[model samples]
Target: MGLRAVSFFAIAVVSILMFHLPYREVKTAATESLNQRQMLLAKQASFGIESFFKEQRNLLRHFAHSPAFLELSKVGKDVIQEEINDHREFVKAVTIYDKKGIIKYSYPNPEKVIGKDISSQAHVKKILREHKANVSDVFNAIQGFQAVALSEPMFEDGEFVGVVAFLIDFKHIAKTYIESIQVGDDGYAWVISRDGTELYCPVPGHTGANISETSAQFPSALAMAEEMQKGHSGTTTYQYNKIRSKITETITKHAAYYPVNVFDNLWSIAVATPESEIYSEYQSFYKKMIFATVVLFAVLIFFGYTIIKDFNLQKLNKELEKRVAFEMDKRQQQEKVMLQQARFYSMGETLNTIAHQWRQPLNIIGLCVQDIEDTYRHNEITEKYIAETVDKTMKSLELLSRTIDNFSTFYTPNEQLTELNLYSFTKQIVSLLQEQFESLNINLKFDEDGTLQIRKSVFFDAKVYPDVLKQIILSCLQNSREAVQKRLRSGEISKGEIRLGILRADAEFSIVIIDNGGGIKEEVLDKVFDQYFTTKSVSIGMGLGLYISRNILEEYMNGTLSIKNYKDGAMVTIKFKDSKES
Candidate 1:
């Protein structure tokens, strides 16, 4: 073979390896990255729960030392009903149990079990056993309602006389978690005791469902918890609520566990994200990656053909032009294919989100249906009930329209670059899904140093167009929101902080979004911003949010978009050159 032929072979090998080899390495890294993130998020959720209980313990301690409880200890029957009402949300019921375990005083005048319990309660046993501050796990009360308690020994001059404690209704504590933290589609957070018995679950009907109720089901998580009791911490992936026939069908495939110290129990606050959704990123990445590979291969072929010709240079050049034209046409076709896929995904998600948004109205419509049904059954058939039902249905119909309008706005194709306020833009995008976030109780906050405000102002006002800025902001917010939601499910966010910070450095304004949710895995980090690279499953698209954001900011807006490890969280920075320089 000639020297040129040898060179051609080497170059061909290099091109193929370059295109193919990185994918395997990237895929492995992506898997690792996802695992690490799940672990971190689980830790955060556990810590947050632990902190909440710690605060509850401290509050109970303060009440034990308070003058009112002290007076009750001395004179007894010093009813602090007024004081009790002052902190109704926190203090469920304050009771003084005599050293003999007989309840002496009950606040708010309990209807049942107030003067009943002579002892045998777990908190009473703990006070008898340890003779100190104690917290009890959720248990069915004599009144048949689930309740948890915190108790502390009352002392006059350090002499143990009785136990003063607070009784909390189950709904109050459970609802706090329910209303706080956004759990994506079909995602739910639950708390199970150290013994693997569910103490709190958002699904009211399913509370106290024994972890081993269906021994045939949930074997993995049940076994993992058994191992966890041996002092294991971090995330463990398992499957629950699955029937063999429904494997990968109706059953939720992935469950993440985080051990939280809520009260005395080593409560596992688990948030299960459907594997289908969490792994959607991977599928998205794969599709985009395949597309990128095909395009890259075509480009390499064109490059090789352009430089080296087996025929006359003139004839080969003519053929090269035709091949280049064909490649361009192919690229356009590929883009069209990707867009169609995007539209299909978007259309599906749009429908799902719309359904979620209209749940209230739909429920109201159901209520109306029930009312008419009830009226018909009762033989009333009054105009009052009929009018009420019609009014409600009409109101719901209007809400449905508004929901459709909101979705229409979201689904509208955006392709313009116009002037935009960075802070305002971020706020607007977040506001678009504020209801969803509020329902999940996920905290999303934007921060900017006072000194850095000028830099951001300059960047948005620079030679950069408005549409690019809007697209970049929209993409960043969406990613951050998804990451936050994912972490919340993994129990990875403490205080549920999703912070966006903008800073000025070296004549560039850096817009950074940081979340306490588990940090991105190093494997996922490398190709996270790559075009068409995604970690999503059950969704189809170009996975172009980060890629497009990067392209717009770096290529068109004359700025740089980069992602970096931010301690225990992920930080994405978009650096815009100073307007003065531009």
Candidate 2:
């Protein structure tokens, strides 16, 4: 009995240690993962801040370009109303200020401060001093709310005109960040102004609480805010509340800061998440480890007892053999299943890309069939006509062949480079899809003024896997064609046109596709490259066509693909290197 108790206690210690050991490893891994996630989120916040400013600049440009703003010397109440209506998202309130800093026209009506001179205000002064748009960090408004301001200097001819202030609601911005994030029960995120003032906090009913008073003490916030004042921004981790908070002990929480702009301010968009919350999975793993260790010890004791009770050890050997076999079979089965699933996913994506490639040629073939039928009906199907049609058919077939060749060669992953005529290569591809474009009443044209050649290149040099490029071009053509079709369907497009141009300038070669398909909406344009982003309910492509095409060009071919609004249409330009230049 003494030995048994000693053994049990030994087992218990081993079990506890086993559980505790993995707990340490898991905690370390968890901490690393949490740090990584916080870093990514910080990067995203930085991007969002930059994007916000870009949107502001764009809004200012919109007003600058407007005939109303350009023609009217003095902004009226009605003009402010129209501008506000046009840009509701960016414009919290459009208030036109006089040279004396008096509010001349405010859309939402600040009746109390209409004649007040805020000319000495920092934002207005900054705008006047810089002669350009000035962005402000979070601060108390002269009115009732907390906000940031984007003040653009209005100009009259070459002279500095009055200022136009677009008040950005800080409450809304903080609310968005709060609502979008999934914070742990005890974790929170907050924004602080450069003056050590807490601008926004995510906790319920705690909007104006000074961050310095919180259990976290806002040390990181103060550090980041100082950095923001110097126009520097990034993420950092720190330990705080070690003595005051129960959960913060031994846990290092991370904070990320995005400086508002180029201007000096103590304000930054800061995000904080508890390191322990992110690594909470380690605790569960530790418990399971302890249980497993205890079970292992129990099995050892049972084996010893059985060996003493019966000297027949053959049964034990057989049981061990059976258990080992069972484990081996289970592992083998799991590996096979994993491989099959992986193969299925890969093959499915490949087939989808292939389907997009096939649609164009099949449409072209259908058109040829119609052309042949029409000619026969008109008795114009002479041997010469038949020969011409046959020749066209053969050419189309050859195009499909070359597309296949390019695509098949890409699957090897590792292949030697060789000389390639980029001109002829793209020509074949365009020809294959030309008939489909014509059927959609899109005027497809190829303009190549110089010979462009690539040496020892992969599909990436061509901006996609040969087959993937086929799909991408087809998808683009299909989108343009469909856009035309929609207009035709609505009797809106009587004479639409699509143009495809390929040219070489200096060492750069470019493919420009322009179409008279009313351009994508401004709101959707920014998200156009996102995966599975689509305006239509059922899209022709998986929305990965452009995404994958871009990867091939920039990542593989060292090229660029960009889109812009053209005259009454959309223009997509793909620019790549003339490999010989390298």
Candidate 3:
């Protein structure tokens, strides 16, 4: 009887050990994974919010430097009204304050807020006293919406004049960026200011409330908020009573938080989900483990130790294989979603570029029609005048038609190749962009005058997709134009210059575009061709120009595109194998 009791006791001990060890390992692995996912979500959210604010600030800075805004009195209020009209999607209102912090001009029903004193406002005081730009915390605006002020100090002749403030709709931004974040079914993200004021929240009555005052019941939440306030990034677990559909229940949550620094103002973003939700899969596994352990013990007592050992080993191996397959499937699904998102973004950028390309031609068509009316009104309408107007109108319309064809062919694959003179093809693109660049006081120079000393005997013919090549050249010129314009705006150069030329070698020919805009930074020089990487403001660039240009050159034309810092700026070179070699 004693020997039988000892055997039973030893089997029970082994069963308990087996169950506890696997359960603990699974729990630890699950917790680590949940933490990593939460942290990644937090980081992504933080970056997006940071980028949004930076774009807004850059826009405000651009507005502040406008010639009309700088010389306010001479320009009249028409310019201000026009500016506001053009950016109504992002800006709620535009207000200009005098040195005394009294509103001197406002757009969209100016009488309501103009002449009002905002000198006492903290942000206004900072601008007045420091003569520096400031971004205000979210506040209730007289416009009857929660808003934030992005204010730039206006300076003229090295003297502070006043402030040009753009009121950005806070709720719109939250809705677009913060509210869109979802981590699991019940997870949500929230934002808090450095002062502990909730900037955004998913829960009712939580937004705009001070965290220190409202989170008294949740010590863990308060602690996490304190860490975020210090600009520390990490993950934590907390408990709070979540109210849903009139039902309240205490639930533990795992969260990851990160800080967003915008113009020296710090804000924290936290993404959290219930712990139960995170461990839902593991809960079923736990029950299965318990049941399996009981069965194994019964087998040990009845069928002997060898059968039990083999059964347990096989079960463990099968469980590991299942876990591996599940993880791989999940990872693949995530990759597919990311790829879809990238394609959508690229399409949106292409559409925007198309609109921009159409705008100038459309305006020219309108002007041509207006000219005929004006000539008739003056009683100067003659056969020659009518003929000239019709000619100009037809030319503009033809250009518009050609633009449509180019856009269509740009996206269509396997386009038939055409043999064309390389120099003439490049000169044509330069001519199209020359007038536009001249309007911005930028010189777009090609080797039209033979100043680059090209040999008359050099062969310049190459067979390629004409429309695709044109699109690539146009994108490069546009990038150079923007860079030159940036330098022009910063007063770094009195005149912006972009030079385009062709070079011939033994094995290949290259088209080189060099600009006097500042060179690319060393750190980001390599990433210039990376998708969605841009130094320019978001509204001005989507970082797809170079990326697409390089890809098309390589994939379609059997060519290459390369860029590096040249004398005073950047040089982009497009190379193709010599036509003779082909």
Model 3: which ten-residue window has the lowest total lDDT?
536-545
| Root-mean-square deviation of Cα positions for candidate 1 versus the true structure, in angstroms | 24.9
List residue ranges in candidate 3 displaced over 4 A. Answer: 1-7, 73-76, 244-246, 296-582
- In candidate 3, how many Å is residue 200 off? 0.7
**Pairs clashing within candidate 3:** none
Best to worst by lDDT, what's the order?
A: 3, 1, 2
**Model 2: lDDT of residue 137:** 62
- TM-score of model 2 (CA atoms): 0.50
* Runs with alpha carbons beyond 4 Å of true place in candidate 1: 1-45, 66-79, 110-117, 142-144, 202-205, 241-255, 262-264, 281-582
Give the range of the ten consecutive residues with the poorest summed lDDT in model 1.
Answer: 536-545
Better of 1 and 2 by lDDT: 1
Residue 189 CA displacement from its true place in model 3, Å: 0.3
lDDT of each: 0.62, 0.61, 0.76
Which is superior by TM-score, 1 or 3? 3
TM-score, cand. 3 vs. native: 0.53
